[model samples]
Target: MSLNSTPQSVRVHIGLFGKRNAGKSSVVNAITNQEASIVSNIAGTTTDPVLRPIEILPIGPCVLIDTAGLDDIGELGKLRINKSLDVLDKTDIALLIVDSTIGIEKEDLSLIKKFNDKKIPHILILNKIDKVSDKDILLSKSKKLVKCPIICISALNRIGIAELKQCIIDNIKEENTDFRLVSDFIDENDFIVLVIPIDKAAPKGRLILPQQQVIRDILDTGAMAIITKETTLKETLANLNSKPTLIITDSQAFEQVSKDTPIDIPLTSFSILFARQKGDLSELVKGAYSINNLKDGDKILIAEGCTHHRQKDDIGTYKIPKWLKERTKKDLIFEFTSGITFTEDVAKYSLIIHCGACMMNRAAMVSRIEKAKELNVPIVNYGILIAYLKGVLDRSLEPIKAKELLSVD
Candidate 1:
């Protein structure tokens, strides 16, 4: 609840995964120095993934995810493992806690394979080391997984706490130095007009996270943000001392913004920034062409990154669906799912339209896109679709490498 918790918990998601009674809860408590999870002999007590935001010396600010035991039994146990696997989607660094007494497990191997498939970097924690006589043997088994850094720790005794923190710090991937959010798009100190139209779909009395983030990012780069509604966009530009550096607008109002902003100044949308920031921009740009492939009566899935109650005219549910139907001139069958509910079942639809995903880490958003690709389904986001419909997708996506957009046609 304190501001100090924000830095460590806001950026990274450290997921603790292992079989039942494998010291997952113990490790969580040890790292956080709190009895965050109930340590128990009873299996499957942690029904869902328990999320605790904590700051550690090594891992910085991150969310500690304690998953239900993967080895749970019965119908309830099945639900537990499913929940654990679902937690994998948000995991930035995975700590595979293995009980030294158990040595290795089928559940451990399966969890490792899943992490490997997702390219998630992980380490092995040989927990309850106080109970094991031969620590080397358990570590040897862990090395077979991915040259996993195996640490001997006694959560009961608080031994190796510093060592575990160091291991976590070693694995955290700091943001790349080469990446520039606003500077990459325009020169330094450039003034950019931001068109945020207030509508019924807009969150009541507050700007959405992506818009706020983009505004902050622009200011962070020393650029000026001239925020206004689409209605005032034309007049605001007229009053500026010079042509504003560029224009960024919501995908929902891209058409109006593009028309109001004169030609020559680069124009794009917040959704495009997300395509680059959180999701795969290149693939989505290419997928934009597929919108033309849609026929009347085809099905499309508009998925939101995080679940929240929608206003009367929610962008994903109301505006996008209606826009798609109008653009295609087809009675398109539209289905809506919010949060991390996407699955292999989406193969039945003609297309999948995702949100800007301001709330999700870049990795998880890309992973969802990869799964959609594996199913041979075309998945685009709300921004990309709006850009495509407005006929400015290329202009919006100009920052991406040319070769990446070569597949756009």
Candidate 2:
């Protein structure tokens, strides 16, 4: 990834949803001025969700997701429909395209109900307006059903697309600028040490996403960041003229970094910082305590945000499970999921151990955490879980002021 290019995780996710052949693909092409999706007269042409990243002026970077029609049929069609619906979990803004010729159907209403139920900001669009003689009827019918802005557009002719873009910009709730990885916790001119290990599993010629983002945040706060390897961490600290404000390291080096650093200076890991930035810190802290309640044969789900080639000693599949068994001294069953494939039936799992989620947007990560909470399942991220297993969870959370959240009792 280029430093200038916007990361997909930070972009606004706008999803196009409705019944088949409702001009969803046409709307995508018209708005983007490119054949981003395949438009077809045949229903169910789009078998899966299509994602296109485009920079919309005023709205900044945004991702448009064109999904399969909801009104599909047959066994295979049902699977496609579920995939489209699943897009809602990460959808920041939704565009419901209704064919004006066909008017509103039960499926469209059901989609609207889901948009409302999820509290997702959305716009109701009546496409193929050129075919319909009476546009008022299309507008009136939808207005009665949904309490949202309704616009009529002819996607083929590129009409009303500018207005649609403006509506999307308007509906976008301003992000919390105050929220950051570590910048919010430190002040300008403060020295922050980042201990990154270049291991066999590390990506070639680049730092991972979480490390890159944290460095950027530190620079944004006008703070100084000193990068070093875990092997040279002790020497690097001794060389510093003054004590640094905080020391952040990769979770895999938590044991050594915590041991090498002085007790007065604060300490934490990159994954723990991301857990607070991407998901709920307090909930994850509480979930860490639940590790004590594990028993023999308890089923645990190990979930990752993105899929990658697994090394011999992968962190999620190999290291975490091993440490967990040793810590609890129990025979626990583990299931693994990677890259946007989290199971909805979360009740079956006794616990959910997730990755740092640097590859996923905050909305998607929060949705998973919320779903687990709704199912009464405990969810903890890789950093917090590893910190607890290392017997330094309290010290790891002290820098972020999250140690108080450990009072789950």
Candidate 3:
């Protein structure tokens, strides 16, 4: 990942969805103007979701996800279909492609229902319009069945691709573009101190995603960021002539940083900042309260947004679980999941502990949090849970004092 490039987590996730042989791949290729997804006459050519990040006109950075057909057959096909549908969790805008020659089918209608159920803004794309006679008839039937914008295009000939792109731009909600990591509250020219630990677990010679993103957000706001390791945090503060606005540190170094920083100065962690930016801060804080209710034999799910090489004491796999067990003093059953693989069957787990989600988009993180809420399962992220364990949950959250959402008192 280049520092100049947009991170996938911050880009608008546009998903192309439809049944097998519905020209989903064709729509993707046509819209991107590149061979982003393999297009073929064979059904289910796209078995897994292919995500390509590109800058679209007016919309800026966007991720187009081409998924497998929903109407697949056989046992293996079922799994492929499941994988394709999982893309819905992170999809900001859905592009439902229908073969105009065949018209809308049961599968397409079912997909529309899903789009409505998820409340995801979607556009119905009628592909292969050149092949179909009486395009108006197909359009009439589709408009009657699906209550959304419809556009006809011949992906093979690149006809109406421009209109489709315009439709996508039109459906982009304001909420999708208004989110900021930490720029909304901070002012320009303010000095922000970032304590980044360069340990073995840290990526060699580069900062982590959350750290990089926070610095970028600060710089975008015209604020200055003073970067330092935990070992030099005290000296960095002493050398500064003016008081910094706030101090943000990694969750792993929360205790030591808290001890070094003054009580009057605001302090927080990168993970906690992401809780408000990427995930649900209020819901996560409530979940942190549930940590005290853990009993023996309870099943807990520890989920990380991205997968990485594990050290002897990885934060997600080792430190978090160890701290949780020691704090609760219970024989809890732990289930771990990393990357984009989040178990939909969350009822089996008493609690869901998620990472900071620097690698995931807000849509994906919100989807997971919503799922847990629907099942009445408490879900907290790594930073919040760590603060709870360190007995500084309230102090760690002081930087973002969202009193309406968090009842830290």
Candidate 4:
């Protein structure tokens, strides 16, 4: 859960998926009023998925995801198409862009079927309406396949964009603003002890986004927030109330924090809340158990969404890999992939571990999770895996009412 009891990833994720040359990028640029993705007549200009976070007026915070063309040709095209379909896994809303002049084709219909199968809420955009003489015919044909609101627009001219956005706002099946953190686990003025280790890996001056977000959420809940490193946790807690409501710590410090904090107080890591925020928490909890069954020599893929240059000891590459190796004792041939390299071929790997993904949108995360499930591979995130390796994964999920929903044992 979030610092305020809401999931960490409560932002809405909207994806634009359709065949190439159908103005998918143009539509995204039009909706967002910025050059979010590159547009070209080329069949496969967009190879990897592109994501942009925006605050639409009256719609709140949302992430827009742009994917490759589904109708790409050749061997490389097939891979790109697979990746585009992968974006659908976590998409809360899908915008199907259709070339109004050419009308709906088989490729567009395939995406519609997939969206239906995923049960994702979607909208149909009849793009390039200005280039068509018979706009009526296009609208009539599209209504048969998708019953959602259809907006006719010339993305090049910015027509119907406001209406389209308003429709998106109206279609939101769920809306949450108060989005709180773990404060609900405590009393009005109860204490929430946050254990943060000032390791070399900690950012130069500022706290990481997750930690900062937690602090803000705690303050928002009118609770007493005490932050300290592992060395200061014991003394800090001892100086506080007889019982703090909840204690949250970075997964990397789980073992030390667990050893220091008494069991009566509820505890969990930043990752457990993130798992619920960015992906499916329950499914990941279930997947975490499969880690125990992992044997030596098992192939594992540790995935990171951001493509930034690594520091001396990067968490995704150096830290997690070393931790897994030490715990598993298996000569595991681990592989690492970046944002544009995620694929659904998990059959060859024993497990897949990902990061917090502040750089990636919710749709992309969902897509990766769905692919791992399709390959029948156990997938968990950095926070979850770190807590598990630290031997305190259980206490980390204490605030979740559904923590009992999945027993890792």
Best candidate (score: lDDT): 2
Model 3 spans with C-alpha error above 4 angstroms: 1-5, 402-409
The Cα local distance difference test for each model comes to 0.78, 0.89, 0.88, 0.78
Can you write out model 3's per-residue Cα lDDT over 1-409, one digit (the tens) per residue?
A: 4423778888899999998888988887887798878878888788888978777767778888988889999999899888888988999999999888888899989988988898899999998899988988888888888789999999999999989888988998767665577787689999999999988888888888899889989999999999999999999999999999889999998889989999988888899999988867989999999988889999999999999888879887889889989989999899999998999689999999999998898889999999999999999999988888887788878767733345543
TM-score of 4: 0.81
Query: Candidate 1 lDDT, tens digit per residue, 118-212?
Result: 87878888888999787777677667764667788999899998898898888766641112345566656889888998876677789877777
Give the candidates in order of TM-score, highest first.
Answer: 3, 2, 1, 4
lDDT tens readout by residue for model 4, 1-409: 2223422255677889888888989988998798777889877788888877777656567777889888888999898888787777657788988888888889887777887777777888889999988877778878886677799999989998988898788776552222344544555677788888998778788887778777777787787778999889989987875788788888888888899988887888876766766667766776767777888788888888767778868888888888877887778788889975685467899899888765555666777787788778999898888877777777677677633355454
Expressed as tens digits, the lDDT of each residue in 68-122 for candidate 2 is 9999999999999999999998888899999998888999889889988887888
Better of 2 and 3 by lDDT: 2
Candidate 2 yields a Cα-based lDDT of 0.89
Ranking by lDDT: 2, 3, 1, 4
lDDT, residue 187, candidate 4: 57
Per-residue error for 308 in candidate 3, Å, reads: 1.4
RMSD of 3: 2.0
In Å, residue 391's CA in model 4 sits off its true spot by: 3.0
* TM-score of candidate 2 relative to the true fold: 0.93
Which is the winner by lDDT between candidate 1 and candidate 2?
Answer: 2
Ten-residue stretch with the least lDDT total in model 2: 400-409
The segments of candidate 2 whose C-alpha lies over 4 angstroms from its true place after superposition are 1-5, 175-179, 402-409
